[model samples]
Target: MENLGVGKVLLVEDDERLAALIAHFLTQHGFEVRAVHRGDVALAAFLEFKPRVVVLDLMLPGQSGLHVCREIRAISDIPIVILTAKEDDLDHILGLESGADDYVIKPIKPPVLLARLRALQRRQVPQDSVRGALEFGRLVIDRSCREVRLGAQVIDLTTMEFELLWLLASAAGTLLSRDDILNRMRGIAFDGLNRSVDVYISKLRGKLNDNPREPVCIKTIWGKGYLFNPFAWEV
Candidate 1:
């Protein structure tokens, strides 16, 4: 696999040896990696590093990675990949619920983690000089900065959430199949059982203030996937 000039990475892992190894491996793969061992200082390091993405360990001394993830999500839309020891569904669900873009369970393989990171990077929608932004009534999505504004309010979205929203909104009224979305966002084919796409969509709807019970902005079409109702955004 080719490296697409991947940007800065902030890695938060308590294991010194493992952190050093990951840092070395990622550095060799053309990523500027900053390793921090504590979860409490993770936000501070993140602010200082200004990393394009984050690799956070689930277990840390000062604070849990889930807490750190929530704190990070409160401020930025940067991609976050969580690292955990357990292979349980609780960990996976909690990681995603905590606002992580992806997760890697331990007994970690450098190449696999690298590939996952690369896949996340590929999801970023390039800023188009001509298009600039997308306007849908009261909602405005600025492609240049990946900022979403609903009238006077700024909607905070995680990197994955924004990517999914942008993809759906870009298509506007058209129905984008789950397979198509998964492939575009993660660079992986849908495996039928993976519900990450749905998870992201649910998060997106919540952030957009669309009622989960009957979402007007982003509608589910039963077997067909989702459709963005551009007209519903009008105040």
Candidate 2:
């Protein structure tokens, strides 16, 4: 097992036994783990603990996990991983749509969860290959600060949204297929049925104020891929 080094993690789980087990396992792997047993208090814990990553469960008391996820996303772009026993596609979609960066179907294997957490940590490090900031007319994406601004107004993007936008903007005007996006962002190949990429694209479009029906910023080249129009932000 590769030591992931010390990092703070917030675990939101209603099940006491599961939370304790997970917290213990992660602590053993050098993580400072804080466990919260209710969804309503999850945000408070998150604010106080300032965890680098959040492991959230859907079936939570006091509030739904999706609600907590959205609350956290509104204020921070910190990585969130949904750990739930629900295996349905709808549950997965809802989790991702609510701002989670990763989803793990549970009957928890500590090693697998640890691996996912490690991956999230790796993603936080700035990419040395990409430029520090990308400016397109009124839109600016600052990789150094992980900030995006449209004109004078700062845009609030979830972690996944920002990453997806950065990926597209970096390869402006080029068509990146769904398979390409899935592999690049999630480390998984598109199975023809997976819609995670589309979900994030929709989210990016909404935040960027691009009309989905006739988007100018992120254009859909049907049956092929997506293209980022670098010249469309002038308005």
Candidate 3:
């Protein structure tokens, strides 16, 4: 396999041995990996290193990983891939809610981790064929800048959130099933259990100030899929 050349990665793992192993694996695959052991200093390292992606462990010495994830997200739209030992759905949901773009279970497989990282990197690159912003009344999604705005107010979105919104906006007036969403965004077919899409949609709706129960922008089609109402953003 060739090097992806995705660039710097900030790894926050308390286990020294595991961190070294993961860092080594990533380094071999053409990434500059910086491993931090404490959650409290993770933000500082992030600012200094300015990595393209963050691999965070939920359990840490100082602050928790979730806190770090939120802190980093507040300032940057950098993609975050959380590492958790627990296989529970709640933990995964928590990680995604904390602004992480993806989650990897511990007892980690380097290859799987690598694949996730690559997927995120791929999303960061704007599609050459699709250019400019998609404007809908007061709402505007600028793919070139990776920014979204409602009138004069700019909306803050995590990396994954932006990707999801862009996907839906690009296909305005279309009903995208969960399976279609997962496969297009994450390159994996939905198996009726992944709730990441729903979580992200809720977040986007909240940020866009769309009423959850009576959402006009992104509508839920009952048992079918989601639709981006091209006509609903006039307000």
Candidate 4:
């Protein structure tokens, strides 16, 4: 973990005591941390630190977590993981929708948080320098920037949307089973209810202008799963 190079981290928590503890824990784990209570100061510190990642608390004195998340996303694509006291599925999903790369419920142990942050930082690092962006006709996916473009149209996608689309595009024309997708998207033992993945798929299809009735890109493989038709880019 020491080789991770003490990446910069910004923590926005109103609880001063808890903030000190979290800051200490993160520093011990090789992360340079700046903990702030106000969103305004946090934003300023973020620019100064130019952190590789952020740990944002939903409850803030100056700005709501959602507001901060949106503002951060407007300027950059730095991966953000929102901390929330509520464990409701909808709340977590909303967090994802609001540009958060991940969500962690309260009562998280220090080790768990450290592990998740490290994982995120690892993913954020550039894995390929020479590999060209993925191009399927109008849909352009820049692997380096993590951005999507349809023809001349720039599109915004949630984290889950991006992940699902990336998986399908990477394996175009290959059928991926629903269970496999669920595990990959959520986890091997994800406990989400039945309609969660389905809902997300529906939403993604809408963004891609994919018609279920006369499907173009994503097609159902009957009882199997979904496949991204590589040939759709032509028609």
Name the top TM-score candidate: 3
List ranges where model 4 is wrong by over 4 Å: 1-6, 127-130, 144-147, 156-163, 177-188, 194-207, 211-216, 219-226
- Residue-by-residue lDDT tens digits, candidate 2, 23-45: 99999999999999999999998
User: Could you give candidate 1's per-residue lDDT for residues 86-200 as a string of tens digits?
Assistant: 8776677788988999888798999989999888777664655325688998999987877899999998877788778888999999999899998788777776766777888
Question: Model 4 lDDT vs. the true structure?
Answer: 0.75
Q: How far does residue 101 in candidate 4 sit from its true spot (Å)?
A: 1.1
Output the lDDT of residue 50, model 2: 81
Q: Which ranges of candidate 3 are over 4 A from the true structure?
A: 1-6, 126-130
Candidate 4 on 86-128: residue-level lDDT in tens? 8777887676666777777787677778877876665555535
Model 3 alpha-carbon miss at residue 18, Å: 1.1
Ranking 2 against 4 by TM-score, winner: 2
Q: After superposition, how far is residue 86 of candidate 3 from its true place, in Å?
A: 1.3
| Location of the lowest summed lDDT over 10 successive residues in candidate 2 | 1-10
TM-score of each: 0.86, 0.88, 0.93, 0.79
Best by lDDT: 3
**Model 2 shows how many backbone clashes?**
0
Query: In lDDT terms, how accurate is model 2?
Result: 0.88
